[model samples]
Target chain A: LAKTTQPISMDSYEGQEVNITCSHNNIATNDYITWYQQFPSQGPRFIIQGYKTKVTNEVASLFIPADRKSSTLSLPRVSLSDTAVYYCLVGGSGNTPLVFGKGTRLSVIA
Target chain B: DAGVTQSPTHLIKTRGQHVTLRCSPISGHKSVSWYQQVLGQGPQFIFQYYEKEERGRGNFPDRFSARQFPNYSSELNVNALLLGDSALYLCASSLVGGDSNQPQHFGDGTRLSIL
Candidate 1:
């Protein structure tokens, strides 16, 4: 399983963009990076995923460099509700279990 | 459509007792996975079952076991529970198995407290 490292916590003001980066130096060639957001008492919700370059969705954007060693999750115009923990996962396309690190606790203040 | 659903949102147990948590996958989903999340920590993988068969197991001890039914639902059973076993038990389901790239839907989870 590929291990990921991210910030322990971050604080952002409301209406500002938040970018959380994760490092996976040992990521495999077939591995993909995925991001999820978790609110209190709720399961982690999928935010975005990308294999390389950039992938954007209605919720967020994922930017993966060509080296695939790292990726960043960008949330535009964050609100107080966006205050939650964000996890970045790196894994192959197999049945391997997901490995979640401590994750970055994002606090969006109004 | 309804997302993944878990039974008994909250459970309280005592040491040496046993407990079983249930999960129902989303419509058309065939894979269900179990995870344990302790306070201030991310979830730890427990088991992954696909098509009613075990596909993956985590480092948890034998006291932690799980099984899937023909309908793609799953149950996680733990015996000889210790106080350290207290945590939020989560269940996730994906449309297919053996693919980590695919997004898996998760349930709110069952809060189990060992007394």
Candidate 2:
């Protein structure tokens, strides 16, 4: 399992873009980076995933550099409803379990 | 289409008591996993079952156990429950082929409160 580090919290105003970055220095050759969002009283929902470079979806975008040691999750035009805990995970390979860090608390304030 | 489903949305138990939480994976999915989430913290993986066999388990104690049925539905059973065991028990499922890269879809979870 690749250990990941991320901020504890971040605050953003509604309609502003927010980006949360995660660092995984020991990322492996077949490792994939993924992000999940969790609201109060709900399960974590898949947001975006990527191996390298960049991957975008209707919800968010994931950007990875050549080093593969760090990745960022970008949410555009944030809203109050987007206030949630965002988790960046380094996918487990070869029967390894997916480990989660403390995660970034993204508060999309009005 | 129906999403992942967990039974007994909420439950309460006492010490030394045993409890079982049920989950129905999304149709056609084959892998199921269980996780425990305490307040103000990210979820902790408990166990993952593929093809009715245990694939992976976290650092959790032996009191935490789970099994996947032939239909891919799963049950998480906690024995001799402790107050600290009180938390949201989540169920997630993924396709076998997408085991590594595919995201696991989660159910709302069952809130277990131990007295």
Best by DockQ: 1
For candidate 2, write residues A7-76 as lDDT tens digits. Answer: 9999999999898999999998888998889987788887888999999999888999999999999998
DockQ score of each predicted structure, in the order shown: 0.62, 0.57
lDDT of 1 by residue, B1-115 (tens): 9999998899999999999999999989888999999999999999999888899999899999999999888999999999999999999988764434677778999999999
Give the per-residue lDDT of model 2 (tens digit) for B34-109.
Answer: 8899999999999999889999989899998999999999999999999999999998888768445777888989
Native contact fraction (fnat) of model 1: 0.56
In model 1, which regions exceed 4 Å deviation? A92-94, B97-100
Alpha carbon lDDT at A109, candidate 1: 89
Best by the lDDT measure: 1
Colliding residue pairs in candidate 1 = none
